[model samples]
Each structure stands twice: as C-alpha cells, then as structure tokens.
Target: MSAVRAIEPISRGEFSKMLRRARPPPGWGKSIAVANSGGPDSTCLLYLLHEYFSSDGTPPGNQRNDSTSNSHQKANPRIVSLTVDHGLQSSSADMAARTARFAESLGVEHSTTKIPWGEGVFPPLPAPGAPFEETARRARYRTLFDEMTRLQANALAAGHHLDDQVETGLMRLRLGSSMLGASGMRYCRRWGMGNVIGGLDWAGVEGMRRWIVRPFLGVSKDRILATCEANRLEYVVDKTNFQPEVTLRNAVRHVVKYGKESAQNFPPKLLQDIETIDTALENLPNFDGNLNSGPERLRAFVQEMGREVEAIEKEVDEITHKGRLPSPIGTFLISKEALEGIKDKPLVQRALVLRILRYVSPNPWGSLRAQAKRRSARLEELARCLTTPMSALSKPFSMSSQVLWKPVLKRPKIVKGKSKGKVPAGWIASRQPPDLQNAWGVADRDITEPLLQALEARESEGDGGALDILFDCRFRIRIHLDAIPQAVIDALAAGITNLSIRCDKELYYPSVVLRTPKNELVLNPADNPTPKFPEGIAFAKPVDWVSIEFIRTLGNI
Candidate 1:
C-alpha cells in the first residue's frame, strides 16, 4: 500500500487562481452576494472572499506573479453574505443567525431569508429522512435570488467545491443522465436561465444581469477544511448529510469519502449498490499519486465533457442566430429555409426546438408546464414539423404554454414605386391562450405595476439608460429608462389592468388592452403604427425576459 499524501491548507494564491478560472462577467465582482449556509464550505468561502476582495493587510506568502495580482491589493468589492433558512429543522434560524454574526465580524453585510414551507407556497415539509433535498435546494435559491433583487447585486457566489461536483456527477450517472447532466455544476452561469435547479420564476430577475458563480468548484473538500483550520474560522455541521438514505447526493458523497465496501456500509445497505469495487478502489487513498490520481481523472473527464457541451452549445447559438428572428409584436419568425438546411442534423434540430420553446413558453423553464414540454419525443416531432412545408402542418400545435401556428408561406406582396415586396417570413410562435384550469388556476395576469416599478428604479439612475424586462415569459418589454412616459406612469399609478385578447388569429397579439382608472381603453402597441412615447415603448431594442412571481403571474389571458 502506498503512503497517503498530506492534504495541505489551500493557499491564498490558489484561491485567487480558482476564482479567475470561473470567468465571472464584467460587473460581477463590483457587488456580489455569497450564499452562506453556516457550513464549513460556505464559512471558509466567505472568509476567503472577504480576504481576497478587501484591501486590508495581506497575509505573508500570498503574493501572485500574475498581472491581476495587483488588482486585489487595494480592491474593496461590495460583498453581501446571504443565508437561506429552509425552516426544515428548528435550529435552521439559529444557524442563520450564527452565519450573520460571522459575516458581521468580517465587516461584510449579511441578510437571511426564510422559506415559508406550507401549502401553495412550497411542497409540504418532508418527513424525517425523506427525500426533500431537491425541494429545499430549489426553495433556498428562490429565496436567495429574491433577496438579491432587493439588494441589486450583480453576482452570487456559492460554496460548491470539487467534492460536491463529484457527488453531483455520480448521482446523475446513477440516474442515467446524459453527458451534459453528468458533467456536474458549471463554474458560472446566468441566474434563472437554462435547466438549472433554481431557474423557477426567471422573469422576475430577467435583465438583472445577475450571475451565479462557484469559485471553489476546483478546490477539494479536504483542502477547504484545512484552510478553515489554518485561518481559525468556525462553521456549523449539518448532521443530515451523514444519513445516506436521505438523498442520492448524500449517498454518493459517502461512497466518495469512504469506499463503498466499508464495514459500516458507507452507502447504506438498502440503497442500490451502484458503485463497483473498481470505482470504489480508485477513491481509496492507499495508492501511488494518492490524492490526485482517481479524482483528477474524474475531474478531467468532466472537464472534457464540459468542453464538448460548450462547443455544441456554441453551435446551437450560431444555428439559432441564422434561423430565429424576433418579430416586432412578441412573436418569433422561424425561417423555413434555415430549418430545411439543418433538417439532416437531428441533434441540432432538437436543440434548436428546445431553445425556441424555452423562449416562447409562457411559463418559466422550471415550471410544470415547461417540464411537460421537455419530452424528447415531442421535441423531435416539433423539429420535424418545423422543417416540413407550410401546408403540411396546417393546424396549430401547443406545447410549453406556447402555440406554433401554421407557417406563413413566402409570397410577394403588392409593390408600388419600385419598392420591394414583403420578405419571406416563415412560421410564427406566439403565447398559448390561457385555459385557467387544471395546473394553472389564475386567468388574468397583470404586471403593469411591477413592470413600472422596475422601470422606475432604472429611470431614476440616469439618462442613456435602457431596461428590458420579460412580460409573461413571452413578450420582451423594452423601456427607455431615461424617457419613461408620463402616460405610462399614469397607467400604472392609476391601477391599470392589462390583458391580451385574441383579436386576430393571423396576427401576433393582435390586440393588447390596458384599462385605465376611469375604465378607458388604451391603444394596443401591436395595432398602432405611429405610437407616441408611452405606446412607442415597444420600438426599443430587445433583451432577455425571464422572471418569477410577477412575470409568472402575467400569463396570456
């Protein structure tokens, strides 16, 4: 048996390197929030971030040779420590309080938000040792992002480390996930976008430009604990993690830490024995290159798969760029020629369909409606329909709360004075009319006030500022921040009620009405050709539209 390699405390330089590798967006570090749970991982991360960003006296032997080494020398980033209490246990609040004290000691502002676990708000609290990890996680992040909106942060930093990544990968593998899922967590991603766990209610945070970053994803758990000890940092331990039966992730973590064949039944006897002796042996430390050998291989595999997925995603982006165009009135124009060009590439077709469906869906990606649309067979069928001729798909199809109507054939319109006819516009994707029953009980969705409030916040800052918000997860509502019209303000201020009506089947949102305080009908932007400032608001450039409660509630009626 080989001797075990010593796990050394993570050096300051190493920490800085990990953060750089995360590739945070331009405005990320200026104002950041940390999702601290009072655990060792988060506690250590908080201390490291405070030290890394602060201009205080630098610890000896922490100098870096990189050009950006001097960047942190006198840096003072706004670091807010945020903690979410799931309220699953009685001590959850106390744990959050302790985290606040720790953050205060480091001179960092702290905020703790509690999740109200009850009927309609969240699923009923799980029974003892029952499967509630995913629910708790989703609700925790949901609350975190809500607080972030209130604080107006540019980024969120999490404490997910390499060990956590490995556990995630293993759990996904056990669940028979694809390479993309088994690749585990990303270092940085846009908040409330993609098929991420906490992407629920994305419209609320759309255009916020907020990112969730994991700087510790490359660091190991052993090294993290060592760093805490070296820095004399204190953190609480959650006993729930030790019970492998509670969750698949916890079970995988046990197998990774202690070999699966441990006398204590490390993975628990009742759980399926998914890990083989070969994989378990690889995790054991009694081998040459003990610390780096097996885990490094797994990390390399994940990284390689991540690179492949990134390339595929880039390709999808390129394909969509040529194929998809947003119409002036909230609908998307799909070029028939572009779809035919990629008809042979089934993978790209499915991906493209997924992207478009996600964009046009009235509900967020994490919602039940959106989840139902994620079926592989449905995507494949949609891809086929999209590539087929306009006459083939005569009937409109509905999925993900959006309707894909019959394609508009390319034809030359009446020309006058040497002017060219209307160009070849293909299929139109619009929001699905509300059923107001079954899963979705709410019929009317009015977000005029919240939308106005968001615009007002941006308007107060300065001129030359523009804000784009997603309305009903379907329409991209762009407003000139500097030129918020008084009429628009009056509409919201007077408690205006807005709703979309199917005035014309051929037109995208033919008529959208806004009722004023005196029950007056405001003109629909889609119907108006030469609208004034308030109605002219739709003329601005488009931006991302994903949201939470307010926008989630703003469904098509």
Candidate 2:
C-alpha cells in the first residue's frame, strides 16, 4: 500500500456534513449529551459541537456564510457534557474536573458521575484473560446512562473516530466476531437494552431507546487532534494509552501506530470491503449489482430462503392458529397436514425446524454465526430422520437442552350429529421438557436454583409489595402479593411444594411469565384451571409491564 497523505484539521463545514451523516431522524429530541473524558478526541468534539450549536456564536467555517446565518441559529441543539470518573487512577478526579471546566467555558451544561468502587455497586473485575477494559467500559456506560436519564437527554454523542473504528474492527476480527461485528461501529444506532460494553445501552431511562451518534466516525484521530490544536483547545492526555500491558486495545494501538507490518493498520481496500459487507447486511433481501459483484448469487440464495421461511410460517399459522398449542406450557403444535405439505421442500422443512427451535430457545439472540452453524447441522440430522416416514416423528428429540419436539396422535373432533374426523398426528415443540432447566439471557446460564432461592429468600423477608425479577433474560416475572388472593398467599407461605405458574395468554418474544409458589400465572386466561392462576386472583385487566425496567434492575443483581 502507498503511503497515505496526512488529513487536515476538520473545518466546521466538514463537521456539519459528518453530523448530517450521523444524525438520526427527528423525534430523538434536540438535547444532546457529549461523552467527554477531558481527552483530546472528546474535547475536540465538545468544542466543535459548542461552536456549531451555541446560540450567539458562529463556527470557524461559518463566519462568512451570512446567508445561512438564520438557518444555523434555528438549527442549534441543546448541548450538555457528561463526564464519568472511573476513579481507576489517582488523577482521574482531576481529569473530570478539567473536563467540567472546559464544558463551562463552552457554555454547555456539565455533569460528573463517579463509579462507586468501594460501595460494591460495580460488577466484579474480569477473570483472567478476560477483557478488563470491557468490564470497565460497561460500568462507565451504566454510570453515564444514569446521568443522561437525570438530564433527560435524547442523544449521546461520543468521539469515536476512524482510527477507533479500525481498531475495533480488527479486534472483533481477531476474536472471530460475526460478519456484522467485523463491519465495525455504525455512525448512528438505537441503544437498546442489550449488552452495555458492545455499544448496546440506552441513553436516557431504561427501555426508552435512545440514539448514540458518532459524528467523528468518518474522521481520523489525527484530524481531531489537529482541530484541537487549530482552535487552541486544552485537554488531558490519558497515559494508559501507552501501557500496552494493561489492555489489548492499547497493544493494538501501538501496533497500528508503529509496527511496519502490523495487520492492525487497516488498508484502504480492506476498509472498503468491511463497509461493503456492512451495507449488504443492513440492506438484507435487497441488494444492488453496483456494489460487490461476488455476493450477488449468495444474496439471491438468502432472499429465496427468506421467502421460503415466510411461506412456512404462514402455513404453520393457518394450521395451528398462529403456531401455538392449546395445552401444556411452552408448547407449539403444527398440524400433520402442514408438515406433510412442506415435506418435499427440504429447505422449507429445515427452516420450519429451525423456527421451532428458535421459538423455544430461551436466548433467541445467541451468537448469530454459531446459531446458524448449529442449525445447519441439526437441520441435516432432522432431515435424514424425517425422511424415514411419519412414524419416526413419534419419538421425542432434543434440539438443545431447553428445547424438545415430538409427534402426538390427536383425537377426533365431534360435529353436530356426526364425527368430523380424527385429526392426523401432529408435531409438538416445547421448552417444558422434563430435563430442561430455566435458562437465562443469551448466555443461557442456568438460573433455576438461584432464582428459586432468591424468591424464597424474598418471601421469608416478608416483602409484601410487588417484586419484579428478570428470569433467564427471556422473561420478567412480577410476583405481586396484591395480585394474589390471601388464601393462595397463605398457602405459599405454608410451604407448598411442586408449585407451578402459567400464563393465560402467550407473551411475545422476551415474554414475561408470572409465577407463584402454588400456581403459574400467564397474562391471558387459560381454558383449564390447573396451570393458570385461580379465577379469584386473576387480573381483570392486563398490566402494563415494562421489561426494560426489570432488566435495568437486573443489571445491579
């Protein structure tokens, strides 16, 4: 690769263009918060945002553009600076104070939050060979998000430049990340209630999705430093960047900066390729020929597969009235006719099997690449078994520890003055298999014992009000004393063993299951009384349950 020319300091016009590219659509509110660490990159970002958004000022490149002055005035966004003092270093407080002072000079509102290390609020340190940096990052974001909520900010901007993107992409590539992960950071994304370290946390209140905009993502770090120099901005330098032994990121940075043959130094073509892959992924089922010509056939294949999946889902819905069964918790029933119809379509059959597995799996959002490979292997095995005739479907088979499928004979239905006919044997998929344990979240860590113990402890503590708990990252369980009858509560207190809870109606993905010591309660009423809550304690109206709020609380636990 030829030597690249040095990038010039970013002008206000250039910054504005970058902002346009990174800005999310309207309704995110005009309030913006900057993640300032008093470092050069973030400090430069704060300065630029101030210059552009300050009501009484004109930015460097906009001073002579008098025709657009009024428009610029109307476009001013409310800016605030948020500083997180991790307190990892002795000088961390000083750095935060400096950041506040700089924000004050720019006339932006500032707030500082210190992670409580001594209070046992933060999570435990990473294990050996684990990413300590990532653990710290999650803590930092959690703190920042708390402040952002107090400020009622809609968008949080970070100074992650082109170099940071390249570093992250290389790191993910090295770690065998999915294609989407290797594509690197997006310019703008909605921070949902997912992992915090991987840039998947909300800005304001939990469950209220917020925007995280990286306007400098297309600009280089050198250009940001140059911008700071050109404007005479004062910023603190983090010495930790030079300590390669402390974190993998610093090691990658060193290699990118000084190593002659380091793969960390992203070539232009490689960067372009990553972007192309990202674009293709984002525009799924829709591909243009102008981009990578090699993926056209692959793209066509996926599109066809998607269509097949949809058709299978529609047929299943029609046969089973939306892919669900009448009885037995966590069961999905498919008519024998529907299965026979798709038997000839091998791809469709595999797709149907995968869908059933996904529906029952507690962690639906498991690693995409791993899940795909597992599904392919399982599908092949299932296809071979399925070819042995309908009789083979009678035996129960495990998809995973948490999921199982079997064929059952359906009794004939009676019509007026006649027998309609015996319904053919159908397939049943369920998560309630005898050997299955309650799996939590995407990691699918077994939390059955811990959860049962927690509930028992809470009950013993005589906590009378509603207690919400997140179970297996799949559902939120709200145990409300007020919602239950006194008789059932007394029974629960009396130590009823083999208790079960069932919902009256099915909750969608990330479903909330209502449970008690004696009866399993669902959101909807069930035809039978065994699994559902007793009629006396049944809720007359649906409760507005917020899953994200439960997850936010779960983070602390």
- Model 1 gets an lDDT of 0.62
Candidate 1 has a TM-score of: 0.68
Residues 188-262 of candidate 1 have per-residue lDDT tens digits of 866643342234434243533567889888778888999999989989999988877666666656655554543
Worst 10 residues of 2 by lDDT: 548-557
**Angstrom error at residue 25, model 1:** 4.4
Q: Tens digit of lDDT per residue, candidate 2, span 442-493?
A: 2222223443564567678867555454443334555454455555445544
User: Model 2's lDDT to the true fold?
Assistant: 0.57
Give the Cα error of residue 475 in candidate 2, in Å: 6.2
